[model samples]
Target: MTDDKSTIGQLPDFDTLANSLIEEGVLTVAPSELHGMLSGQLAAGARFDPDTLLRVVAELMDLDILNGENIKLILLELYQTTLAQLQSTEFSLQLLMPDDVHQLEQRADALGGWCSGFLSGFGLYAARHAKLSEEVTETLHDLAQIAQIAAESEAAGDEDEADLMEVYEYVRMAALLVFTECNPEPDDTDEKQPLLH
Candidate 1:
């Protein structure tokens, strides 16, 4: 857990990592999108071991670009951290996304991709295995709608910035809600105390 947390905190620059994946011809989706997919799957109860996780990520990205040992290790650690974070008692939606310095249109595009990936991941299990509540269904619908958003370079005004911020927060909260609904906290059952011998 510590390793996972530390790695997450000290992650390499998003652009650098993304460029590496692109250079390797392996990154089909943006970093945020990839992480969203992984998180959605885990939250929906997909149990994948480290190797399996790596394989799935590679497939999602379109190839096994982890030809290098360091990349492989880093990705594995990220997967572990993501899984742990999803299952955490202090679970929160902390997307490994690009910084806010990017333009509004670019951010919107990235968000759309992330939403698309999230829906894909959630549907993987929710469609077949689990029974979704009405709320979850609605959330999924909302996300599906969001996935269709396109880049709109209107202006660099405060209102637009504020709206973008709101959207970002909405996505974050909506994801956390979905995760909570899918992975409910364990009920406290302590009717009988442990016997002290």
Candidate 2:
């Protein structure tokens, strides 16, 4: 198995994944939202298995099986890259979204979609847990609100751009917070021992 840290700096970028999806005619979910859904599942302690991940994506996105192989490769890479970023000690998580060249409203819309996907995936698994910490509960509530955000009717000015970045940063950190809380690292010293004769 590859070390999670080894995969840290090698994540596939948003445009590349997005373009590939478009070329393949899979338009059901944006790359950002797909990444968010995977992140949410990982945060909720879902095990990493390529087939299972592909199945979940298909079900969630209403994807057709005939187009599965190529999409499966993309999804697997995304899953590994996301899992690695989450497990890294350096706090290197990055949300998948378009570059700054894109208009603020478009990016904001993607961010909202990402939050929606995260909530969907998180809610699907988080229900198994009897309770969540107060912090996590509040964070989920905040994410839900973010998911509903719509950009202003007027042209976005500098202030709107700055505000959008602030919201983006909050959502990024919120994802990390959820992951950290739900998937605490196991203690090395707590490893199980073999039974003695």
Candidate 3:
């Protein structure tokens, strides 16, 4: 756990990961979407070894040329940092998205993409498990609705900004909820409990 906490400090920023993917001509997924996908996987108990990690990234990015060392490094860092955040007791998970410099619509689009990616990743594993609680199902439904969100008007105003911030916080907490539900901590008996059955 301490090691995982230390690794959080090495997490790269959104722009750095986005730029690296852009440099490699990998635009199939945005940085926010990628982070969401990784979080979903971790929450659903999808542990990745090195080969599995590379394969999953290549598949998600639709990349045939994944041999680039720089891209690999950036992706590995993202994976480690995301897993650490999900496992931490501090509730430190952060969604990757455009900063305030970007237009409201652009940020909203990224959020939609992130939710879409999360559903895809989580479904890949959760489908096999079955029997999710009603709360989890409702959360999934909410996230699906949020995936369709867009800027309602052309000119964004202060009220719109406030609404977006509220939505962002909702999404952040939602991810943590899913993670906690899927990966409960071990008890003193040391028996691993089944998740969400």
Judging by lDDT against the true structure, name the best candidate.
3
Q: Which stretches of candidate 3 lie over 4 Å from their true place?
A: 1-7, 151-155, 186-197
User: Can you list the residue pairs that collide in candidate 2?
Assistant: none
For every model shown, what is its TM-score relative to the native structure?
Answer: 0.80, 0.84, 0.85
| Candidate 1 TM-score over all chains jointly | 0.80
Q: Which lDDT tens digits does candidate 3 get at residues 21-86?
A: 888888778888888898787777676766668778787789865777877877777887787777
Q: Over the full model, what C-alpha lDDT does candidate 3 score relative to the true structure?
A: 0.77
lDDT of 1 by residue, 79-144 (tens): 666655555656444666677788777777777777878888876766544577888788888887
State which candidate, 1 or 2, has the greater TM-score. 2
Query: Among these predicted structures, which one has the highest TM-score?
Result: 3
Name the lDDT value of residue 4 in candidate 2: 52
Per model, state how many residue pairs clash: 0, 0, 0
For candidate 3, give the lDDT of residue 93: 80
lDDT of 2 at 107: 86
Question: Where does candidate 2 stray beyond 4 Å?
Answer: 1-7, 66-70, 150-154, 187-197
**Residue by residue across 54-89, what tens digits does model 2's lDDT show?**
667776777655274656666777887787788778
Span of ten consecutive residues with least summed lDDT in model 3: 188-197
